[model samples]
Target: MSHHATPVPRHRAPAQPTTDYDVIIIGAGSAGLSAALALGRCLRRVLVCDGGPPRNAPSPGVQSFFTRDGIKPAELLRVGLAQLEPYETVEVRRAQVQRVKPAGRTFTVEAEGKSGRTFTATARKLLLATGVEDELPPVPGMRDLWGRGVLHCPYCHGWEVRNQPLAVYGQGKIVTGMALLVSRWAPDLVVCTDGPGHLSDNARRRLRQQKIKVNEEPISHLEGTAGGQLRNIVFQSGEKLARHALFVHPHQHQRSTLAEQLGCRLTSKGAVWINKHSQTSISGLYAAGDTTSGPQKALLAAAEGMEAAIAIHETLTREECPK
Candidate 1:
């Protein structure tokens, strides 16, 4: 691959003016930043718009990432930003994307800065890595202790609370599956259904085999320690079940509407649908990370971003240099 320089405009007065950037990546989390790095190294003019803190901002530390395990989420992003400074072709802006308008082969993106100033920039290709947002249960203290005592991925935080009294919150087959998965880390596990545990006979039998107890009492609220760790699950009848941590698979949705606005195909689970090459239904548009259906992890998201970059580069190369 050959590297060529493309002059980028320092500023544009028009609300929506085309830029020299070959790619415009929205959301500067792991996936977006990784793609920007790869594209920048290719000497492609790229603009990465960061939409503030990532979804993992509430988590105390990032887990399972190579050489960066247990590092704070914010710190991990800080390191990523520092490393991108050397890539002059990549410009990262602290702005939230508000709108995306596809014009033939290019896209015009409208964004609002921290100062509330709105500007627009256009690129030949656009990548959406805006991630997703988790919607927790309505029970009290759930939000307060989220990412601390309350978590979603056992692979990410299970070891931190291993061998401790744990609880999985949900009903039906989902909770049963989560309980079984969580049992790998701790022996003292229980399922809190908040009401009726709609489990099949086989599911109940499986739970009994694993020695995991089931609590079907309606929950009043969750109790947490001053340090933000979960202490107990309070039932409506005033009974409290001591627990150190809670695992849940909350419903999630895309953090940005750009994909929908651009009419990209979506999965039944509400994730942006992509082909093997990370291209969406739209020819010049792409998606990666939690924005698409699959296991959501920092390592996986970064790898997807790298793959999307390679695909985009190859496509661009084909278009610019005809055989």
Candidate 2:
């Protein structure tokens, strides 16, 4: 099986790649779409290519953005796209960028449309806002529950499942801290190590003091409804712990290898490395959102995209359209 499934893409044909754009943004999530908006406002030629579903597509609603709080993820994108309608310089295509490489001062991107037709485009600057895919632990039904009853960030999902029976699925020192953080909303909490006992004495003591139960047994599977609503965690020893919600620190990797193929440096944590302006190690190439090494949130991604767009616009204007 594939490591993870990408989110579904919107239905659209690849835009004719006849003209070289000022900027090509390789994601249509908050980051890519926001960058397109900012660049479009500057009257720059922009192309946004959405390969697949956004990272939060499975979630019921987005959080933490002012005014947009609790808005559905797809709805947020719809609104953003509608706002870009008046910008004639901006174009969006539902295509997967399969490869990217520098060509002179510009970059060439090769993409394929939904109909399996291939197209090539060039950009003076490229933005790799392609987000990461969460790698859930290998337990039956775990993937199905993700973004539903099973989640990662407490800040994003804690309020919804607050005061419910929650469990933290992980192991080792970091997970101990994760358990503590999740306990803020889940007064009745449990930590399942899912393997060997690695929690230090102090961590165990802290969990005990907080009245959190720790289970060291490895998980066999999760029992849940067909719709992915988690109900219970089954252990190797045949014990079952009923839980209304679960939180885990899922390992993530970039959904696309375009950055890696183009020689962009990545952090030790597997995120694209970026500078102050959100530019990656490669010049004229930038990245933002969950792909970059930082706090991952929808609002933060949009802000980063705007920042990167402003920087890119300034640089392009100074070089190409200066007085």
Query: Best-fitting candidate, measured by lDDT?
Result: 1
Reference-based TM-score of each model: 0.94, 0.92
- lDDT by residue for model 2 (1-323), tens: 65787877664443433448989999999999999999999999999998878989999889888899999999999999999999999999999999897876788989998888989999889999999998888888888888887989998999999999999988888788898999999999999988886888898999999999999898999999877789999999999999998999988899999888888899999899999988999999999888998889999999999999999998886665424
User: In candidate 1, which residue pairs get closer than 3 Å at backbone N, Cα or C atoms, i.e. clash?
Assistant: none
Whole-model lDDT values for every prediction: 0.92, 0.90
| Model 2 ranges with Cα > 4 A deviation | 1-19, 321-323
Clashing pairs in 2: 7-53
Candidate 1's TM-score reads 0.94
